[model samples]
Target: MILLLLTVVPVAAFTPWARNDSAAYVFRDHVTGVLEKRRRKLDALRRKGGDAIIRDAVGRGLHWNALGVAFPRDARDDAFEKFAQTVVAHQPVDRAMLRHDTLAGRRLTAADHDAMRSERRRLATVDADQIGATGDDARNSRRRLAAHDAGRLDATGAAIIDDWGLSFENVTRISLKAHAALGREARKQNLTAGVVEATLLPGDVAAWLASPRLRAALDAYLGAKAYVRTRIGALRLTNRLTAPYSGAEPNLLGYPSGFWHHDRCGRRVKAFLFLHDVKADGRPTLIAEASHRTHYYEYKDLLQSRFSDEYISSNYDVVQLVGPRGGGFLFDTNTIHKGRSDGKRGRTVIIADFMDTRKLYTFKKLRYRGPCGQHRTVKMGGEDIACQSWCRR
Candidate 1:
């Protein structure tokens, strides 16, 4: 059987926050004209401490635990072969659309597949250290990160890459375009920006995954040629109606993403591009530095569960993901982190996910995928759906 780590549970089994999402969402923006009461409720959560906020989340449901060990090979050999064979037979890696193209729509050549095959073995050898964790002692991930950022060139120079080809002006232009596209998508869905994050299709995004700087960074991080997830997106976090809109659901308890959690996906790295200046004041992402190697608590229903802030903060040194408008960074999501959603000045960013080539056949299948604004019939829960993906349910 396929090791369906993130898919075995029913949707209703998800936390109450995930269940209460309405398709037509009224967002809490800085705008004074709309949704006053709703905005105040979200503001209150923003003012609260992490520990208190997390308690509200678990207050409504059971905290599930994992049945298996940490980071086990999610794809058994037989299942991987079967799925790979079916994919090769039906879709086939090619020079055109679907699985053959990059998230930004770059067509893959025979050379690309050949290169990937050569490095396929790297996928199986991944450990916490390969993706982002450093050093032997799990307790020292933060100290190690601090030392490197403070001037350990040997460590910082290896995995962190910043030589992306796009200039700040070019990126700013792209960010503007991305927000406009997301706005159109949100209006179509009757949802606003902060809560709904939509994937960028071929035309909307540029083909930068293959850029040498980024490609080399991912190769160093994954120890293999990286495979892109089909659902890469431009993320926006603004309280103003003008900041790009994407809704995940507001947990009456708390924003699920703001709580501490490690992504259960195996070995993968994500590239985050800042579209505007974000300092400590901007609602920047907070990560327990190098916490990927540490396993504080395991959950049975790991898919929809989160770790307590009290436990994570007590153990790890947390830091903000801050940078200029065109700056970017590569990170392993398995590290303990929270994507901050509360801020005064809105934030705009582009996020891309990549994994080792060998991991491509592993993740549980996405039963539905459609263009951002188009009407696509999803065979989920025996009903038609607007959108669905590995992240967007």
Candidate 2:
């Protein structure tokens, strides 16, 4: 018994699980502090203006981050123009609808109340239904349908994504009760502590899985009604208290939290729902618009180099996604993006990934009924989401 104990102890210590846990424990605090310090340094650099870090980074011609070297102005305008043209004939939104303030000590007019309610309803509707040009009222609905069937991002959806790798629109309004409950439950699971994968509680999962707005967004992006194959891949909650650092990461060792990277393997679509308001100082995510279409791995060697400013500024239109509660963005994970953290107030968001069941990461042969009432089969090594079917995967 004494000999067996001695042998097992040394062998087990070197097992993958034991080694990984030991590394995490030993490095979590040290790496986190190192990353936080880097973030503070970069934040200082950003404050120095155009001629400072940005100019220096762009001056170095080795890195490209934005849409293409020459982002055709007309192409960018055309994407947004289609959506605006569709809404051109509608009655103008009341001026009151544009006021982004809370109802505090202000006097309330009936028009003000009506406008507020109208805006709320408008925010809740999906694009197809919101626009008369594509909805039942449109004479062009049939034409739109045919165009959508061509297997690409729908006209309006394409416009947004073509201009940027992601798009933002308010799709759902969770009740205060539900939103609070979600936070409470997430806190109970201590999801904020580390980058561990987790699933939402059963109650939260059902609400998200059955979200009509999410379904609509998927259909719009797919240009066809898609069947959600998985039980909704893990609903991750990230509290960006310790945002990933942006620095010279030679490898994972000096890599800051959430370093600039894209999800590999396929074109994965994810919905990020912010449970509360995310202001500029609140550690909003920074995404390089339309970076998904470029070859991301080309900059691997430069990733660890000292051109941190270039990685952020060169051709990349970095968008700091700041918005009100219930507002969020749907994006292709293949895009270059990262969460920002100042260690100030953290934000809570639920992210759900959607993809065709056939491309889901699983080894076993599996069959299941999708949310869209279609049966899907997962064979090993199936076709993945290509650019043509940006929304389907």
Candidate 3:
């Protein structure tokens, strides 16, 4: 009976879930939500800190805790084989589009060539410690951060990131010239530049990624040594120009609001630099305070349905992140949050993610063109020797 339950469970659960890829996403997210709750509960009981407790519970050799939970090895293997077989049986061959072809009319420009060249030079000669603080400086920053975290001072990097898993740094502003340039570029590429995972033009990347202010803040946030293991991913923009959008969609919180979702299953931090002044009407990102540490039921419900006023009142200490142009926030992606526009005009932000080798969920190979037009590649997530070389360099 035990063996039968193990054999039948995965089939019963995942079969329907797999039929609709959309449903599969929902199911997977729901499972991770439950797991996150369980892990936190277990952590409290064990009195462990800093991912140590959950790591112990989930680690089986090098594999994570999710690998073999609902299925026995043989059963899971059989299920995957059957799924692959069914896919192969149904999939059709189409040779008209070559895999190596770039997107139509997306040819690289002179600025792209320049940016590529600059990026390669930076990567090849970049020193981690060049951006890192000395030991004494880090210690001093930590002391100041601790005070700020305790509310003895204004909110700073230490207070938000160390305790709240968020940072609203009142850092240096993005210059008016740079902001206008970004806006102009957005207008030129209105069709593609502002969406999620949109490949940034070389000029945009060169401007934002090369910001000395951003680098300095990141250095302070990651500490001296921790900053060394970091890699930048997805330096894209969030453009919400078509405002007065509704967040009333039934399927996947269909609306122009920030839906509650974690960025990844594992630990990751993302940053958003507002290129212009952001107000409530601009559809600023709403974060549930400390939702990273505590599981809120409203988050679960909101995922399946629409956001309720009652739900917001009862469940969340919602933090509407409103700030001026050049100001920004950095936050742990594990927190449940949403962003939506409500005004007539759209708001634009420079969005970027900083991934540490320490925590990850999905893995993707990152490729870049070198200064000499040579191909360079590194994996974004998961453990890889090549990533170590790349990050360290």
What does candidate 1's lDDT look like per residue over 1-393, in tens digits? 456955885332221122122111222121122224323433454455322433333343213222111111122234323322322122222111122221112234677557644433232222233435333332243223323432311122113334344566667667777798778778889864355566675344453443334543454344333454434677766674322223463342334566666554423467777776787767777876655432222212233335455555665678777877666666666566777766766777777765443334333232212112222222211233343333333
lDDT of 2: 0.38
Ranking under lDDT, best-scoring first? Answer: 1, 2, 3
lDDT of 2 by residue, 1-393 (tens): 999898887321111122222222223333344344434543554454412333332333223222112112122333222322221112122111111010111244566447434433343443345343343333243334323422232211111211111123322333343455555656777654433333443244445444434444454443222323332222222454453433443334322335555543223456666656767777766666665443221111223211233445554677766666555556655455666645356566665565543344221122211111111232111332322112122
Report, for every candidate in turn, its global Cα lDDT versus the true structure.
0.44, 0.38, 0.37
RMSD vs true structure, all candidates: 17.2, 22.2, 15.5
Off by over 4 Å in 2: 1-197, 201-205, 223-240, 243-257, 295-309, 361-393
Quick one: best lDDT, which candidate?
Answer: 1
| lDDT of model number 3 | 0.37
Best by TM-score: 1
What is residue 148's positional error in candidate 1, in angstroms?
A: 9.2
